[model samples]
Target: MIGKLSMGAGAVGAISYCYYDKKATDGNGEKAVRGELLYSNEVFITKLPNTHLHLQYLAAQYHQVAQLNTKTEKFIWHQTFNFPPGENVSNETMVKIACDFAREFGFEHNQYLVFRHRDKPHEHFHIIANRINANGQNTATDRKNYERIQLFCREMENKYGLQVTKSKQKSYAQSSSVQADKLRKLIDKHLPTCQTLSELSIALKKQDVIMYLGRGISFTDRNSGVTFKGSALSRHYSRSQIESRLGKSLVLQAPNSKQIAISDQSGSKNLNTVIKSKFPSQKESLPVSKMISEHNNATETRKDLAKINESLRSVKNRKVKRRIN
Candidate 1:
């Protein structure tokens, strides 16, 4: 199940239109507000108010109930249904399931306004809830709230026999790297034909390839290997896209003199010196000679040490003989 939390503020007008039913007459003989037509795109399943304004109001009330004055009160945590089309669960059932989950997660005080938005291809619901609990206590909405919501979603899916999409847990960095790899391949394929960064930008735009520009050239897709002149790409693409694609560019100014060093005798000698210093001697026996020299030196040192020790022992033996005489 995919779940996202959104805070809705300044939507009082939208909320107020949900509860006004035009067909129903008011007590004073006034025609009831035609809220149903206004909210044709919205399906309210629970006891919560139908208007977006009322939903926001309830959310604010709950925000107070949860004592979350410092935190934003107008919020919606959206969850997608795990059930397949064959299960025949109506959009209303999904909305109710979501509302029940929200209530379980400390949204009990204010009524939850659940609306199934028909704007998208898939059936998704919008849940507006007050952030406060009953008895006017401030509710906590943090990472833990998200985890509990996920747990509840899992349980509900099992109870209703819904197909659940397993979420692959990944750090932001890992996911970003994966995305970068994908973009890099796209960039590499288009880089050669892109004579200028603008041309590259146009090519990428056609492919829906987004990139960020930085000081150093960076490619979003490894395969595309797109090169961006920081200044050129910055004007065409968004800063975020540029930064996201090409990291910061490294600017190096050309030397003023631009003196071309000719490979004359001096240059040749210098080159030879560098090569000789870096490479082994052409003579293969050079290493063997050095090894032999080292071994001889070591043998001589051992012999000298042995001779010294023998001399010391001889002197001690003579002293013992002299003392005995």
Candidate 2:
């Protein structure tokens, strides 16, 4: 899992983006509000529907509290917890984790909301809380925030049996040069036998190298647990570059998770359940999908190569001396 924290002045915009029912289109012509409220603290009322006004009202109240601590210009605390791919955590568990972090980090009394966003390949939840609580006090402290979070996330992972992200930090005591040498050796040994990018990942794991595919490919030495980018080894070792070498075609598939704006709204219950419960198989894998294509240039190069290879094969009757750059 990954933990991130940011602070801002606007609350309504943040709240609406996470919990709004009506669809709001973004620059990409996609829904800006692509998630549902897993749990909300003070935004709900018995009879009144959660409208734009209600969102504004909560923001206004939080801003009112922000006035008490004029020193804290950024008064809205926005926290997001990201679970790794293939870790099927439930909605209740995610909410519990966020609430646990809040109580431990000294924001228990603050008004907050948790939203589960399934618009991406991996599962993640966001927590928007008032930095200035109802009691006229600053709840969030920036001092040593990162250090505390590192430990807290580890504790939570251990407690809940979630994927431990702190392994890299813990096992990263070895020199980077040593780690890189090990990674390079492994890649050289295994690259020839693998075909698909996913195949290469599975092959590396047998040798104790944990491959993480994202915008690019990275490998973690299971012994040292130090992760190094593929580009660091060589530019050709990148995700798309490797795919090009392997002659794998790019498959642009949309996210299988349907966006839900309201928690009460009904959709395919099985799909939603699978999104939360199902995990990926050991051999088959997907890159960390915060964004689909990180190495677009390299990916484009691969497509061009594929087309060129096909064209060359078609003109095999004549000797065509084609030099590829």
Candidate 3:
């Protein structure tokens, strides 16, 4: 299990996202969806079925508690308990783990929520809490909080007999330049698989990278929230260049089939030349589509030859007329 912690100023916005934020998607770029709410603590009122009305109620409830603390700028305590994939954890256990953290973090009395999110591959839950207790005591301080969470996670793993995650020192050590380079390479690796700009964007979403295309291109690292201009990373990754790379103009068909498929794998080869190269044997073995293409070429060649013969006859007639006159 991994415990990541952060502090925010707004309680309503933080809690609302835990209730309704869509991130997961069906690979075909279909409608994005989010997970459901699992557990709630200190219910002041019943949950409403309508998403908007319930979120409004939650906003009011969190702010009512937040008004107790006017001095603190950041009163939201948000953390996520991330379980490794393939770990079968029950909801009761999940709530118990969240409550344990609440006790440790001193938010047991504050308005907090524990929500299970299925959008991610791993089993994880978000805990959103108002750091201001009922008595208006500011019990939230994020100073070296990550270290505290790591220690707490290790203790939980031992108690629950869950798979232990080896702690690493300063795991988020990659600089922006380093991250941009990594993204640059990833885009290059996936460009061949993409046939259009939209296709490339969809492909990169699975990796948590966003590709923006327009007159100029840019890329965003969803994890780090850093966006890089195409030219900033490398000149080769510019909008027009990447667009040209993804825009496959050649329509390839099978030996005798007319099912057109867009591709750029042939690289600078003309369509007819590619067809002939693939089918070097007798014409009888050629596909219907290729035969039709060859027939058109033959017709054009014959027309050109006939035009040349007409020009030669006209030239001879003009010379004979000049001699007769």
Report the lDDT tens digits of candidate 1 across residue range 78-186: 3333333334456656756765665576655444555554433454555555544454444536444434655776777777666674532111122234454555566
lDDT of 2 by residue, 1-325 (tens): 8778788888888877676535566665644556677777655422235222356676777777778778778888888888787788998899889889888877887778888988778889899988787667887776655447777788889899998764223222222586677677777667665545677888888889888765566677787556667787777777867765652222223355433221112332323212122345554444644235667767899999999999888787345545331
Task: Give the better candidate number (2 or 3) by TM-score.
Answer: 3
Ranking of models by lDDT: 3, 2, 1
TM-score of every candidate: 0.35, 0.47, 0.48
- Pitting candidate 2 against candidate 3, the one with the higher lDDT is 3
lDDT of each: 0.48, 0.69, 0.73
Give the TM-score ranking, best first: 3, 2, 1
Clashing pairs in 2: none
Question: Could you tell me the lDDT of residue 90 within candidate 3?
Answer: 79
**Residue 115 in model 2: lDDT:** 86
